[model samples]
Target: MSTTKTYRIILSGGGTGGHIYPAIAIANELKQRFPDAKFLFVGAKDRMEMDKVPQAGYEIEGLWISGIQRELTLKNLSFPFKLISSLFNARKIINRFKPDVVIGTGGFASGPLLQVATSKGIPSLIQEQNSYPGITNKLLSKKANKICVAYDGLERFFPENKIIKTGNPVRQGLLDIDTKRTQAQTFFELDKDKKTLFVLGGSLGARRINELIEKELDFIIGHNMQIIWQCGKLYFDQYKIYNNTKHVQVHAFVNNMDYAYAASDIVISRAGASSVSELCIVGKPVIFIPSPNVAEDHQTKNAMAIVNEKAALLIHESDLEVDFENNFGQLMASAEKQNELSQNIKKLALVNATKQIADEVEKLLKK
Candidate 1:
């Protein structure tokens, strides 16, 4: 028998935790399976990944690139230059690392890294976390050795033959939240019996969703419902003192997300691809407030994919003012509706996506 070969893999993604965390989860699995494997990450320079990757105990290189500024600014003129620099840098990194395979999660840097990796005859894979594919993933797919997707109907974006609906790989830790529902109540000092609503605005938080909750905090309480609100870091300090009573609570971030998800009867969140993927597993009756700020309005497209299937409800940013509280009230009153959504969205859950992604990575190494 031949000896097993050690694999060196390069992982690329950044600009958001939605992309970074899944990359980490996939890397974590590879570490467990191939303890001898080497891994490197590439992310946009001066972005969150510079801090996050080191924190995750991985070595990452930075590309001097950014998204094209939607509003015309002097920085927008640097797009072509940045693209050229990133291409040169990606080639340098790939040649030095000599990885057997490359994996791209959605981010500003993934475009160049994966494109070069594919050109070099290395097997490249992309994990598209959204229901509607992002433009980077769409372009990368033409050369991707395999495309793993979370949502169906993605054939419109990638070659159908290369696509695998593996869902988003959620950290196993989140799924194993300490089964302490009452403990979560105590953790947040919440009323154990009152209906709990968890408001999430993606990994960072949604300003519009947070504003809506702030506007309707009293009405939410007056209706005899309790809340565990994650106001995101930006608005955290402004609202952290919102502990008017046991029925309402505010947090900058929920360290124990599994607890927050477990303690809640309802969730109000942005429709980020990862949020939608994890929510499908959490099985909460969710109100998706899709942000219009993202590229391609991907957040709304993600939410609509589920809403159109009747697996969830959508509240557009423009409609939040008029529809949020009223629709939320109706959802809270109807356990049947909540249960139906909960069951239906769970149907889309692929809990084994992490292992599956890793398995595919391992298979490529042998070939």
Candidate 2:
């Protein structure tokens, strides 16, 4: 009788929840397929992933690594030292772990780890979750055996032969949100008769988005609309004062994300890759206020991808002060417009993204 072989895998990515969660989702799907696979995660030390990965039931190792801030600072001076240390640490991990496959989602830790893995001739894949690739992923693309992307035309950055347009992995549960609307309304104690607006700005929160909600609370309430506002963890207290009011509810984080999506007739969101993917699946009319602070201005690029398709509206952070009320009010007043955006965005949803990414890994494993 043949004994089953244990496949070893090395997955590296982190920093924000955007990178961490997709790496976790891909790992989860791979685990389902290779039940006996041994997995190890490499993330930047002190990053949220160190805690989040273990919470997701995986063992992880940390590299002494971080990104170089665009603006000059002391951290920029330390980047070379950090990169050297990370590369050395990465070599040690690869030699010790001896992974059959190395996978990188976009993050600072991924660069050194995947670079070291390729030097050793190990099979490697990268998952780029935006229309525009990040500096790390763009640099690593040359050696990657497969580049799984969430948008088309990234061949401008990656080798066309290596590109695979696999959409970002969103929470699988979000696919069934329509079935949860009634339960979500009940859970939030919202009136069944009022239209609900879901506002999301990602986990740490967005100052501009929080401020917009604060300024428009009365306007929304007066228009007979209810709100499920996820102001993010940072600004929760600052904005929590508006909660439980007649038509407003403020949350630091919405743990039951599917319910939040289900309860909404429309959404106001930041266009992070994971949020964009999930919002596509949620199929709600959305106004995307992309954060300007990200690398490569990728958030704006992400939102534009959808807007180009006429699937959603794009409001820059700079323009939100002038455009927020008018853009939102237009969507609110027109059911026909809302339906158009909803249907068009849903057409871009790749509900099987995790599985497709897993399939790419499976192919690499077979080689």
Instruction: Give residue 103's lDDT in candidate 1 (0 to 100).
Output: 95
Best candidate, TM-score-wise?
A: 2
Candidate 1 structure quality by residue, lDDT tens digits, 89-206: 9999999999999999988899999999999889998998887777778888988888888877889989999988888988676675537677777877777668888988876777
Model 1 scores worst on lDDT over the 10 consecutive residues at 171-180
Off by over 4 Å in 2: none
Best by lDDT: 2
Candidate 1 matches the true fold with a TM-score of 0.91
TM-score of each: 0.91, 0.95
Q: Which parts of model 1 have CA positions greater than 4 angstroms off?
A: 177-180, 241-248
Per residue, candidate 2 scores C-alpha lDDT tens digits across 1-367 of 8987799999998987888889999999999999999999999998888988998899999999988887889889888999999999999999999999999997889999999999899999999998777777888899999999888888899999998888998776787998998999899988999999888888667899888888889987777899998987779888888875778888887778888899999888999998899899999999999999977798998898899999999998889778878888888889899999999999999999999999999999998
Task: Estimate candidate 1's RMSD in Å.
Answer: 2.3
In model 2, the clashing pairs are none
How does model 2 fare in lDDT?
0.90
